[model samples]
Target: MHRARADCTANTSDPVDGQAMHRARADCTANTSDPVDGQAMHRARADCTANTSDPVDGQAMHRARADCTANTSDPVDGQAMHRARADCTANTSDPVDGQAMHRACADCTANTSDPVDGQAMHRARADCTANTSDPVDGHAMHRARADCTANTSDPVDGQAMHRACADCTANTSDPRIVQQCKEIVLLVLLTPVILWVVKPCTGLVLVVLLTPVILWVVKPCTGPVLIVLLTPGIPG
Candidate 1:
């Protein structure tokens, strides 16, 4: 009875419990213990019965915790936190990859649905125009136009061929030889564009172009073309 009265004294002022207060009073009154406010004892007893689920019994924190899941921060975007981190949420993949690639925005490649290696192939997509799929694809095939901007001419004369041609005109002492070298260079360059798939044949042609063969250059103009044919015939 004393213990019940003590609990009643301690918890009668509890603000969260009006119904429990009444129950506590009834339990104390029914006890028939002397020198104690039996009603208060009973009421406090019922109120303080410690229903683990009840807010009045200090279970408010437990309920609140149960209601709240862990706040998981998204890995792709470090700051955004989600309650449950749904699987459908953007995993670690960059959202930019899925959108239309912008020419001005570099690194927007690796679009969604692309395989893993697709990113490597599309790395230059940022420098490409809207209609162009890749930066290199902007070249019109391989036949180079004079301007060479975006290699507008099909059969693209890409920068590699241009640079190769430029390398050919080096270290010429004779005027006649220079003209002959130009002719030979054009023939050598033309063959590669037609059979571009044969890298080795094209590479051999490039070597001849770059060699600055003084003897062949002196072969009046026809000699250079013949030498190109003999040096690296078009691969089958």
Candidate 2:
């Protein structure tokens, strides 16, 4: 049984099975004359003036404060509205355990499966068809529709070619000339593939015309790497 004395202002949970005079625990004050001798309990900010005559079990009691008071009590008694008291009433019912009520609902919502709470609002896996938008980058690929429409860039764009040539020519004068030459060779080889995607007609014509010129420039005695710098663009 719980018991409190004179002029109690705040109190917390009453002893579950106590029938004798009881007072609130956890710094709560109780009125000396109230029934059950005033069971005014307060845990932190949780105030409890639960009248046994009208037991508010599994539900928020008067001034349960924190606003986590549930109207209908749960079997657990008083804990039903614990989350609401702590300013988490948004997702109180069946909220994900241990996570904040608002965040847990975002993570578990049927439509949007956000992995890292406010980071990306898309699903981690592509199979979840609930969302109609395109699968963003870093999202898992869809099983049936393997078409990942994320990075469809033109292979041989002017900017890309310029960058590749820059990288190739930047370290040509270094002692590691062989490695540089190999990179240059790869660039030359990949030029056809990139151009084919962007401007097929122009890419093919350039490939036919520039292959011999580039091969000759790549001879053992390095000639001026000026051919790539002045490479002509085929008119679309």
Candidate 3:
């Protein structure tokens, strides 16, 4: 009876031990599965956060730089527009190149069928004529003309008229002096003929009076020289 009781107790202990081993194996498998699932979820979250934040930040920076570039270039464009408008304002027409205003003014002149513009041009021409016909200017012109004519045809030719009368008798042997002496002698003989031809009484009187003073001043040594040369066969 004691042996039978011992064997029954052993059989009960073996079944209980088998059930405990199955429960332990199940707990270990669940623990391992839990860790793998947690790791996979963590990696998915990390990938999603990185993808979202990187594109958002990069796009924001790109937009800011584009806006900055546009703002910086605006004033440069405005200045170019203003300069073009200023050129147009300065010209009578749209300013294309140099001489635009001058060309416009020339065209305005050509199309002057307008009475007011024609009258203005006429008045300018009349004023020019009046200035030319002023009595004072006319009288001065006449006097100048008379003087030039008389001086040109004077009894003393240009070659004989020295800067100073003393220059005339500078050298008796000089051919120039000989020519001058002949002109002077001819002038003395033909004084009356010159007065008649030039015919202005005032001019004649000035010639008559100025001639002797000029000759005397020119040739203070003339009397002796002329007596020796002009008189019969005196040695030169």
Q: For all the candidates, what are their Cα RMSDs to the real structure?
A: 25.3, 19.6, 44.9
CA lDDT scores, all candidates in order = 0.32, 0.36, 0.25
Q: Estimate candidate 3's alpha-carbon lDDT, on a 0 to 1 scale.
A: 0.25
Quick one: best TM-score, which candidate?
A: 2
Once fitted onto the true fold, the runs of candidate 2 whose alpha carbons sit more than 4 angstroms away are: 1-15, 18-26, 29-65, 71-111, 114-236
lDDT per residue for candidate 3 within 126-210, as digits (tens), equals: 1111001112222111011111222121111111111112222232433455567677766654554466467656655665566
Off-target runs (Cα >4 Å) in candidate 1 are 1-107, 111-119, 122-125, 128-186, 189-228, 231-236
Query: What TM-score would each prediction reach against the true structure?
Result: 0.15, 0.21, 0.19
lDDT of 1 by residue, 1-236 (tens): 23344334333332332323332333432321212111222223322321121211212111122233223334554532222112222213345454321110223333233232233112222332111112233221211222334323222111222112212232232234456677666765575555455676666666557445633554445565566656655455
Model 2 agreement with the true structure over 1-236: per-residue lDDT tens digits? 33354544433334542333234444543332233324432232235433222111222134434433333333333232222233322323222233321211122332233332222222212342221212233322211112323233211110111112212222223235556677777677577779888889977787878877887766643343445433554534
How high is the lDDT of residue 93 in model 1? 38
Give candidate 3 misplaced runs (Cα > 4 Å). 1-169, 217-236
The TM-score, computed over Cα atoms with residue i paired to residue i, of candidate 1 is 0.15
